[model samples]
Target: MRALHAPTRRRAVLIVPGFEERKITKALAAGADEVVIDLEDAVAVDSKAKARALVVRVLRELDRDPARSIAVRVNGLATQWAADDLAALAEVSALDSVVLPKVEAAADLVRARELLGRHPATLQALIETPRGVQDIDEICRTTAPLAAVVIGYADLGAALGRGAELPPQRWAAIQDRVLLAARASGVAAIDGPHLGIADNADFRGRVHWAREAGFDGKWVLHPGQIDTTAAEFTPNPAAVEAARRVLAALDEAAERGLGVARLGDQMLDEAVAVAARRVLTQTEGN
Candidate 1:
């Protein structure tokens, strides 16, 4: 059976316009954990077909790194081009996953997989609309091989008619919902693309928020944002060491027939150990 987990870490996601072959080529070599060729918002309506064809050709031609995940963000399931996009992508064996935009229900995932035919690429859902967010629990509960769920912040904001600058608190609530559902379903949770590429300060703050809030990763629009995402998402040496200490403490407690232990000034329990192990898991291969 196909694995439900992602093939690699997803701390830094570099997404390029699918119609731009040069950009895609550059993205592949940009050292992001995942490179997504975007066929939806990034490509113009007239360029959709071209984007689809080019993405297939590029995936077929390039010698992809097995360690770095490669994905394609196809047009939304509601769009006219989605079926064709899925059908075309079925032939690209190198694809690790397909990011399905505006997924509102569990049925959408099943439909996308069917449209994709025999291709084994995993599905990543983009929750952009109110319906999508409302049905997120059901979407996550689906039996489909969903590797991750990403916040489509820009589109979601626009759809909610909240204008561009929605408050951080509101975004946090939405992100928490996505994160909770993803964790419960055992899938990765990704933050949406930060449009303020030129605003380094704001970008770094958002990355920090994502990390602290337990998001698996944040989307990095440019190579400049990549390093920041990588740094913030990757667990530091101290954190890894702390995780090891926590596990050791738990083991020691177990040997003593105790249900809890003390680590420095804090009390350690199974819950604490779970968090610590998660930190170490994030450090793997970093």
Candidate 2:
């Protein structure tokens, strides 16, 4: 099989489950890279079937473009509705991905793929529980067609008996593990949503932290967070130019039979070139 490419867009917004056509339309217009029609935590137990039906209809209508990158957040395998959810969505050819919640093992992803049948939808795992975190390496390595891995902070914090606010050091350790796991597995590592929606300062700080820690992007729960997330993930023009210079200097040095090059006062080598290439790749079309 060929390698899977990372998503070009950085922000993903989740719409509450069940039918809310107007809200979905507004979310798509909010400039998010993708819109996930959630059928898991957002939907109530009684509305599962209704939400499933509505998502199918929406997928059919939106599948026409295929470039819109629409996805569904299906219930976990342990739930009664999960099988039915996959069976129904399997027929939709336009679905770009499925967000599988409570994925604790590679088997969960394998089952999701089996139910998806011959469809082209990719799987994005939600690492929310302790088991999921512990088995993250195996889960990322074994799961095929895995596009991204997201840290569901709310559920994870709850599982760890952490309150609404987690200590910065503790949270950093968790985030770093997820980031490294995704990197080693060649998939995107997306930070979970920041619940402090009203606190712009806190939200921006979190976004900055995620970028510094090497996350590809973050989940945005509100429309207002879309631009913030996108801006944070985008490489600054100055940084991009500097990266270009690093590559140019390295290329010139290689031609001169030198293993290292000087960029300003700092020495540039293979290690620095890797980061420079990443900057160019991340900002390619931006």
Candidate 3:
């Protein structure tokens, strides 16, 4: 199990409906770290087969880029279309991963792997229900090519009887738990999309909260949300410079056989150095 890191500067993820060809192309070039071609919620009941075929065709035709991830969100395991979706995707060499929606336990991942056969595409678990959230630790710990565990707020909120509209703070505790599990498992923890097209202020606030809550990235439904999401998740230039200075000071002190150092009014130790290093790491290749 290798540690999964954000692939793009924005650390933004965009999900394009599999049935929408134009949207797929737009998402791929939209500066998102990952673009998930959705075959689940975005497609209608009668369009599953057509969407799967279209997604496969699009994937086969697209140029593969190692720097960015291109994944497909197949329908839930229990759905009739999942098996066919997995089978069709098993041989798509251009795909980076498979987004498994509505995962409830470790068994769900196991079943998906079984269905996926020997395909090397990694798995991103979409935890949408109460059971999925409760068993998130186990899901994250599963040994199957797991890359990230994303929280799906729409279905989750509905399952929790919270209705369609949910405040960002309402998800704080759940976000913390998912982040904790992903950290322990050495995988990326992704926050779900805001599920709204308008209300730019509200969207920015939600993105800010996710960044502050320590999420590796966020799912953006529309391309317009990409820049804001990326900007908010990205560390400020001043902060990155400050972190570099702190690291430089700490490294110099260590070379002098000192375990601690002083930078202005702040005492720098291994703990402070650790935080600075994280900030610098986030800015890598920016």
Q: Give the winner by lDDT.
A: 1
Encode model 3's per-residue lDDT on 126-198: one tens digit a residue.
Answer: 9899999999899999978788899999899999988545778888889999989988887778899888965
Alpha-carbon runs more than 4 Å astray in model 1: 1-6, 247-270
Best by TM-score: 1
After superposing candidate 2 on the true structure, give the runs of residues whose Cα lies further than 4 Å from its correct spot.
Answer: 1-6, 12-18, 63-68, 245-274
Per-residue alpha-carbon lDDT of candidate 2 for residues 2-27, written as tens digits (9 for 90 to 100)? 11222455454544444676676666
lDDT of 3: 0.84
RMSD, every candidate, angstroms = 2.9, 3.4, 3.5
Clashes in model 2: which pairs?
A: none
Tens-digit lDDT track of model 1 for 16-103:
8898888899999988888989999999999899889999999889887767889999988778999999999888788889999999
Cα shift from native, residue 168, model 2 (Å):
4.3
What is the TM-score of each predicted model, taking all chains together?
0.88, 0.86, 0.85
Q: Higher-TM-score candidate among 1 and 2?
A: 1
User: What range of 10 consecutive residues in model 3 has the weakest lDDT sum?
Assistant: 1-10
